[model samples]
Target: MNILQLSNRLGYPPKDGGAIGIYNYTKAYHDLGHDVTVLAMNTKKHFYSLSQLPDSYKSLAKINAINVDSSVSVLGALMNLFSTESYHISRFISKDYDEELKALLQNKEYDIVHLDGLHLSPYVETIRQHSKAKVAMRAHNVEYMIWERVAMNGSIWPKSAYLKLLAKRLKKYEAQRLNVYDMLVAITPEDSKIFKEDGCNIPVTVCPAGLDLDQYKVDKTKIESMSLFHLGALDWVPNQQGIKWFLSEVWPKVNSKFPELKFYIAGRNMPKNLLNMNLQNVEVVGEVESAIDFMNSKSIMLVPLLSGSGMRIKIIEGLALEKSIVTTSIGAEGINYEDGKNLLIANNPDEFVTQIERLIADREMVNDLGANARKLIENEYSNFKLVESLVEEYKKMIV
Candidate 1:
């Protein structure tokens, strides 16, 4: 099959979860003996040079990237206040991108044209006009729901009110655009259900993010049993909020009990405010060269997400590496994980303290949980198995 994957940003050098999600699937389809081409908008924030990618990756997919400035401005925000269009979605609309896409569709016939996320939905009509390909919108998350949750958790009046307005506009935009595609590939069954409830008439399927298992194999001997770590894109509002909550409420209690324990935090785009917080035993390492290496060095992974949607890719990678993890119910959503068996789930400060303490005290329990976590990934979330099923689905869709 000739597959063309459209993305809002370059997926190579998969630094964050979104990048990893896009790159892994593209690689999977290519490895399955399909001709895959990835055309992405290289935004200023997550830009990548196509020439910098390794030859092995280049051989897997015919990747191309075009510059598109997606930065926000004060004037643009004010203008959007009076318009029906979503500021979030509108920012991603570019004439150059549309022309590039139109040219691609005109030049080559494709069996499937997969839109990577909600941001790329604006070009559905363009794809329809130029190509006979089956259009599939890969719904990463109900985009509006993330903002809604953020607004609900926010405190400041004016800022929260503005966020509520954005959420309302985004919800309407998302609902109206649901049936525009031939199919919807949701990242989770939970998200599929929500899309149905929102009146999405298109066929929906669950395709949770899959990982290359061999790359994440566990070597327990290398792990520091005393170290705990939190790794995610800290510039995201939810990560910042969750980390703040952990430091203010949960971390203090845990530190009082185990003062010698060190909690390392690492990720791209660490906010200045979060970097300045003076929390005891909390080390803010801005970013790491390799995610797998960082995970292998830590004994327990912390995913203290207060409000976010979709599966946490880091959680999947952590489990795959056989690292004992403690996360909130929101953090562990979409993944089929059992509490107390594969991982520990905690919602409040008290529960977090209890779960962390349990892992700290019992090495055997941690080992058992980590093993169970890796077993779950091998059986259910293997990249090869998931992508094989996805290829079958593509064949069915084309027919």
Candidate 2:
């Protein structure tokens, strides 16, 4: 089956959370012997550019490189007073890409048109209007909820207030358009429920975020340190808020107990505050080549995510690498890991400190939890299993 996979950003090297999910997913479908092509816009906000895509990508799959304008509009700026969060604007949804996509559909009939992010939904409607393809949308997280979380942050006040208003508007817009697609893929059951509550009429299924286990194999011989690692794209609002919350409330508690605990932070585009806050025991290493390698070296992974939707690939990656994880309930969203069994769930600073102390003091507990976590990921959350479900859904949609 020929699959026209649409993505908000180019999916090579899969740096960010969303990109990583799509990249692995499409690869799995490709492995399943489906003829897959990706049509993506170049957001250009991240590390890689169009040059990152090799000749093979162009030959194997139709890769569309549309340069979209993501700047805030004047109306968006005014909306900021009520809600600082703004919907990402893309001027690159050109008639050219639409015609190109339509032409592809006209030439080679596709069984499924899988749209990756909500940001790419606008184009899905365009495709539906012109092409005879079954449309399915994979909701990473309800964009409105993401905006609500962004607006609810205490770190950035005026911006948060503005985002709150934007969230409401986006919620209404998205809710109205939810039924247009044939199928809706939610990253979590919780998100699926939210979608239903918002009147999404399409068939909703829980499709948790995945990790490339091959890239995250456990290394038993490596000497692990008394270090804690937290990684996310720093530019992302959730990561920014999570780190701040950790630095202010959680990390200080952990530090007060274990001053010698080395806290290593790694992610894309570290903000100035987080970078400058690099203290005696804190190391802010922004953007590493291999996040799994970094996870293997750490004794425990700390995910103090407070406001975020969707499953955390960071937690799953840690599990796959046999790193014991300590995270907030929000951080462990959609992951089927049992708290105190495969992972330690902590919401408050005290709870976080207690978990960290337990993990630090007991080697056996850490080993057991880490091992169980890896087992859970291998059995349930593998990319192979995820793509299988996706394939089944595609067949249903087509039938």
Using lDDT as the measure, which candidate wins? 1
The residue ranges of model 2 lying beyond 4 angstroms of the native Cα positions read 47-51, 54-60, 72-86, 89-96, 155-157
Model 1, position 106, has a per-residue lDDT of 91
lDDT of 2 by residue, 42-127 (tens): 65573256666777555556666666555546775765456433355233345656666677777777788988877766777667
Stretches of candidate 1 off by over 4 Å are none
CA-only RMSD, every prediction: 1.1, 2.6
Q: After superposition, how far is residue 83 of candidate 2 from its true place, in Å?
A: 12
lDDT of each: 0.90, 0.78
Report clash pairs, candidate 2: 83-162, 83-163, 84-162, 84-163, 85-163
> In candidate 1, how many Å is residue 127 off?
0.3
Of candidate 1, the 10-residue stretch with the lowest lDDT total is: 217-226
